[model samples]
Target: MQSMEGSNRTLVVTEFIFLGFSGVHRGQSFLFLLFLAIYLFTLVGNGVIFTLIQLDSRLHSPMYFFLSHLAFIDICYSSVTIPKILVNFLRQRHTISYNQCIAQMFFLMIFSATQCALLAAMAYDRYAAICQPLRYAHLMSRSVCVSLATASWTCGLLASTIHTVLSTNLAFCGANRIHHIFCDAPPLLQIACSDTYVNEMALHVASVFVSLGTFLLVVVSYIFILSAILRIRSNTGRHKAFSTCAAHLVVVIIYFGMANVNYNRPSAGYSLEVDTLISTLYCIIIPMLNPLIYSLRNKEVKEALRKVLGGLKKDSGLPQ
Candidate 1:
């Protein structure tokens, strides 16, 4: 956006160029193929899980309802960044229009924030099911689940709106090259021509609220969960209860660890390779790994997938 409404200086930056991996001296084609495969697999994996959840009535519980939304968010979240990454691999100079860059950043923020809150919600769900089994029914009823999900999404959107509004209003002057893979906030702020103190403040506040705050919620829930698990007199029962959250625990570790590394920084650093690698961890790798991670060791998900596959075979008149 360009503006000179009340100032003598002209601020013009209609688009930004991404130097994501353009500095890579070798094998752009290989990079493209690798990520393309990852992207397709990510979509197919999340899509299949999403469809299975929608079609299987057995999976209509509050937990699966949240799982469905998580799958949807993974699909959308990866789509927001991976496509641009793939495109950049084939072009000598990758560029995104001003409006497009802003839109990308907006969605990326929304999904990132929402996923943090959603993980907390899932943790709370697990806590209820395990620590308070007698009242789990009342604690995580349909209405209660809906309320939690709604609150997670509402907080995410509110936080993203505030950050995006603050970011786009900053003057970019003539600087338009983004060093990172995507239109992330830190990289964008690095090139701003105007004062960015207030914007940085808003970013830190939102990061604490969305990222650190939700992470603490998950941590506290897990503490209670661990205490409950330890109290079970039967060792097998204790192991079984802990196993239910094993997958979610793995995801929580990777997701929050990478998110903290990305957003908790004081400013954008100049190591392009390190930046791109970390970005890939959360944006592309985690989303692709989610469905398989959530389903591979889960008896319920495996059985549901088997039933769905069997139905498909019968519908197509293939051998039973």
Candidate 2:
């Protein structure tokens, strides 16, 4: 039997088999349809928000600008993995090539980390708008928004680079089974032949930054935002203030909840099956839910969408 460790004397497994929802047994078709629906909704929901934000001049503010970018990231994040899972469900095979596995992991890390930073940026936006309303416009000006977005992306790239380089250094000499639906970090590290203490250390360090650090920043931002809302004298003022943050609050809850559950806790002793389900929530379900939370709950977004659709209808009727 080949040892789990990849010695220089032996060749490591060149590929990995994704044991997707196959663990659930039976109803593969049902699960396929379910995820297919989720994927489709993710596409349309995020797409609508992105388009509405771009087209509506009223939505050109910094808050909507950041929301548009967040929607775009959600689209990319969900696309990277859901399509593969969908294909696997349809074909009854959940295998991925080693190179594909690496690519998946890279994009997943990039988008996931980017979202963490973007959430923090959004928190600051709320803090400025609510806590320092006088300078919200000046603080979140076009140049500042651009810089924040650029930094968010740069952080994601840097984090992904470190993880990918470290992951590549550790050889997966055998036991090609990935034991999950995607090329997640912990599961992949488990199969590495080299001493993975370094890899685990890096993973924990990055998780700390991306998970707890961002969560704390958001919590602080919201604390001030809530205090500001409480100080408002009028009912309409309170409602408006809460409305401005409701979508973001829901998103933060969903995102940080999944992140804390998955990364903040000890990965030890957890079943791969549980990991897969939780991964699906963060990777699939949250992306699917974000657009709905933001678009449906937001009256400004709804109005923008209505105007955009009305314009399209008018344009379609004007000429043949």
lDDT of residue 97 for candidate 1: 89
lDDT values, one for every candidate: 0.88, 0.85
Candidate 2 per-residue lDDT, tens place, 1-320, comes to 24344443666666788865766668888988998999899999999999888888999988888898899999999899988887887775678877788889999999989999999999999999999989988999999999999999998999888988888887776677777788877788877778899878888888888777888999999999999999999999999888888888889998989987866557563677787888889899999898878877888889988787788889889632
Candidate 1 deviant stretches above 4 angstroms: 1-11, 268-270
For residue 84, what is the lDDT in candidate 2?
88
Most accurate candidate by TM-score:
1
The local distance difference test score of model 2 is 0.85
Candidate 1 scores a C-alpha RMSD against the true structure in Å of 1.7
Which candidate gets the maximum lDDT versus the true structure?
1
In candidate 2, which residue pairs get closer than 3 Å at backbone N, Cα or C atoms, i.e. clash? 12-173
